[model samples]
Target: MLDPLRNQSVIFDFIEKEEYFAIHAPRQTGKTTLLHELAHRLNKEGNYISVVFS
Candidate 1:
C-alpha cells in the first residue's frame, strides 16, 4: 500500500510565494503527489503560473 501524508499547506504556501523549497524523502514517500497538489493549488490561485513536468 502507498501511504501519503496530506495537508502540506505550509510547504505549498512557500512555493506559492515565489520562494524555492524542497521535499526530500525515501522512495514511495509521496514526493510526486505533493508536487502534484502544489501545482494544482498554484494554478487555482489564479495569480501565478505553476508547472510540473519531467
Candidate 2:
C-alpha cells in the first residue's frame, strides 16, 4: 500500500489553514484510500474530527 500522506504537503497546508477543498481523480486511483488515511491521521493527532462519507 502506498503512504497516502507522503507528498501531501499542499493538502496538509489547506487542512492546517482550515480551508475547504476537494479531491478529484479517476476511479480506482485511491481517492477514498487517501481520504481514509487522512482522516485516520487527523484523528490520531487529536486535532480535528475527520470522517469519510461515501
- The models' CA-based lDDT, in order, is 0.70, 0.78
What lDDT tens digits, residue by residue, belong to model 1 across residues 1-54?
A: 223334466675675576777677888867898778767876897876878999
Residue 29 local lDDT, model 2 = 76
Clashing pairs in 2: none
RMSD after CA superposition, every candidate: 3.0, 2.5
Query: Which candidate should be chosen as best, given TM-score against the real structure?
Result: 2
Candidate 1: segments with Cα more than 4 A from true spot: 1-7
Q: Give per-residue CA lDDT, model 2, range 1-54, as digits (tens).
A: 434566366688999998988877778878788888788888998989987887
